[model samples]
Target: MDIAALQRWLQHAMTIEARTSKGIIRFQHGSDYRRFLLRLKQNASSNTLKSVKPIPLIRGISCQLPAGLSLEAFQGQVWLEKDCKISVRPSPYKAKTMDNGIPWGVQHIRAPQAWGTTTGYRVKVGVIDTGIDFQHPDLQHSLLRGINLIHRGRPPRDDNGHGTHIAGTIAAANGMHGMIGVAPRALIAPVKAFDHNGSAFVSDIILGIEWCVRNKMDIINMSFGMRNRSKALLSAVINAYNAGVIIVASAGNDGKRRTVDYPARYPQTISVGATNRLRRIAPFSNRGAYIDIYAPGDKIMSAWLKGHYNEMSGTSMATSHVSGAIALLLSLNPGLPPAEIKAVLKRSMQPLRSNKARRTIGELDVWRMLQAAEKR
Candidate 1:
């Protein structure tokens, strides 16, 4: 079965369960997935593997394999396919926000002053989360045609409102009454990986990243994570980085030092933790060596469902601020590579006053970033 056919079948018949099912598996690449399927077909006589059906799916993923396939058998086969990584049902990071009269996130990031320089025009960003509200007045003008990886047949619409909030923070237009985003003119490419319930498998996220890479997105903001690392996930991040896409992700909300989430934990990506108006790290923001910087996330007001606004908090929100900052930087110097962009961000950050002596870089300084980008 091809992916579209399977998707059509799924849309009409069965729902893909989030957890406790091992029927779904994602491989390192399309060739690896195909090779594994070929092995299954060739070795159909084996007691451990009785099925040999084929299905082409997104980003090297194959889902809804024949029921009753042995997990142990599948694992045994993948263990030998050393070049490939296979995983099932990797959980998603939940959104873990503040306030100035001006909305602390924007003010703390110094976005208003930076807007005097540039509003991130011509910079395209990909928001990889639970879809985005393409029609929200505050964000409609900044959006590009995006894909819905969760339900491949549908338009990428924000059902859970998380991606909308994230998109608004990154690039919502400067309307009369709506809260302004950090980079108000940046274009958002909504890559809906997570379903409405804020849940997704690693495969879903990989597909989103793949779409971002294919479209040559300048930046990608991922506000979700899984505690356990998946090799396939790491490969996807690396691929995007190599393609010159600046990737930013949320440090998980586990509130623990030395335990940031994967993709965030991956060194190629910039991992962000949350801070508040006082320049103090939020208690819920995970810390450790993996956390590259902090940004305003507490009680942040941004576009929500149905053209409304709401305040939310999390490293997820913090991640969007950094993403927007990168967009602004890219708008100034579109040629800046991921490593140089990260270095500029680290150099321009204002250290959190509350965490003095720890040398932690606190909130973003968008104005400073603008100055630095101009030199490039």
Candidate 2:
């Protein structure tokens, strides 16, 4: 978009923005971060906080945490003996199309609906998770240059199946087999921050978000989350939003009801909950004030290990579905801003349940969202 138009859109969004979900917090030692959060119930302000835990190595090797706590908190914390440093060197490689992996969601893609009238733009979407399988047949054409924000080494290439799977969901092509993506023409800028264990440092994801801003990606798909909140992480989202990037993230699989998952729960970020095949919300899909919309997440079909496709379930999958949809939206009109994209998603959403202040949003209707955007 041009300078004057960008300024006008920003000015408009500043006036109509809605309130953000609160009670955000973060802690690592995993399952134990909950009670530790209770200590800060009275002062959940975005201030410095701490939690201390014994490292188990020496039976009493302890680490200190932030100041206050008390409000449900984190899960999935682990201890690895190796201490490694990953670097941030740009990659010189470019992707080449292969013939093995199949498209994951082509049949239901909405891109063709607007084919006759649009320029069919290629949007830049950043996938900040495990590395993507750049050479996968279904993804190569849509893949673009990316950054490694996790291990100082190289974005730990998809030793784990998580990142690759999510990438396929966002931009995989449709000609071959598998299912198709919502936006097959979108370009992917993969940024890896987590290793196979689905584990990562808070600082790593922070660097990933910054990479998205500096690169000026149109959308960022974050399929990971922490039950804990970090000022640094939240700031990164705000910075990226101001620059026009839509941040979509998984509503952490905390198994709790109506909870706040960092990055996903961040005010500027879009949080996605999971739904099963029957169009019902997944029972284990975490819920809370932060959830912006729910999508088909259970047994979701997408690309996986060794350039193959399979079904997996998680809020992660749901997040990518929405990201892919956004890509389709941008493909139709390159002029939409991040905030306006959020508005389009919210307005197109059907009411799931109504609270005094707001109604929970459910699965997205891709065609409806695009139709609404065009009319707007």
Candidate 3:
């Protein structure tokens, strides 16, 4: 059917349904719908029907439609907005007393053993999250100049503390006075895509991925997730992967048995799930065949805002461990591709003690991973 014919049919069907359903269907044949149709026609006339206007970073536009409108009628013609959230626990614990040594997560993953071989020197990790605390002593030397997508003129500094925590997990470096990270020598480039509230649109994330690719980042650490899939986000991820950048993402905190979140669900990313100190899966971690590996994420202490430390838990923490582990691998062999790195990671994992039935997903062993890389 032609576009106009389809629209008329949808309207008629919606109106009929609204009348028969006795208020169950509230079809608003108002300016919103009119504007949407008008934009649709404008896009079609310009031969850019699939692309959303004004926002070049996003490939699709989202709008509310009448309840009875058939989605199949506009198949392949409409794109909806997908909301993304930082994958973190609901509550974060403030560290009352400070400890001066390697964090438990860093030690749990056996990162100290690999430190003798490579401390991930010269590796660049692009963190696309809220932002980072540039003044934090543990992160000051480990941070590189980064961008702020939320405020173009300002620096990408942490406002929500999520990015700072993620950064500390991957690359915090304070030898004597504070805690060290998994890849203490690695540099992190903060890409502020989310706001202070830790909420982000898929477009901002896509833009962040573009920046990482342009900056030639060795690893992209994505500690956020969304339930719905965005084609534009997936495309950006594939492009980054093909550009020889390894992307590590959280498997999500939904605690679902068989479902993972995107872009973690996307095959190009190395999906990580949460594991506690006991080497068992965390209760909040999403698990399935898509989880590439597990890492320590339960009550793990890391850098917070204002040069302090705190304990947080979620698959986001798990993802940072994997990203840091990859940084160590890349420091040894910078030429290794994403596929080979993923293979080495998978082959070097240790079996989880709690969930043995699903042997497909295993816990990360950083020392073993580096050893495996040497053999390759």
Top model number, lDDT: 3
For model 2, residues 251-288, the per-residue Cα lDDT tens digits are 86666776846778877888898766555667768876
Pick out the ten consecutive residues of candidate 1 with the lowest summed lDDT.
79-88
> Candidate 3, residue 288: CA error in Å?
1.4
- What order do candidates take by TM-score, descending? 3, 1, 2
Ranking by lDDT: 3, 1, 2
Task: Identify the runs in model 2 with alpha carbons over 4 angstroms from their true place.
Answer: 1-120, 151-156, 351-360
Give each prediction's root-mean-square deviation over alpha carbons: 7.1, 15.4, 7.3
**Measured by TM-score, how close is model 2 to the native structure?**
0.68
Backbone atom clashes (below 3 Å) for every candidate: 9, 31, 1
Q: Per-residue CA lDDT of candidate 1, range 1-376, in tens?
A: 2433323343332243433232334443565667556655565575434422232323343343334333342342231111122221222333322123246688778888877778899799999888887768888889898998767788999888888989989988855656678888999998887777777766667777888888989999988877776766676788888888899999978789777887799999999999878888888889867788899878778887777777788899899999998888888787789999988888777878763426745568888877766665
Mind giving the per-residue lDDT tens digits that candidate 3 earns over 1-376?
Answer: 2546544543454345342210111112334345555746664653223333223223333222344344555544543333333333345537534575788888988999988889999899999998999999889999999899878889998888889999999999997888788999999999998888787766667778888888999999998887877666776788788889899999899899899988999999999999998899999999988888899988888888888888888999999999999998899899799999999998899998963547666899998898888898
lDDT of each: 0.73, 0.63, 0.79
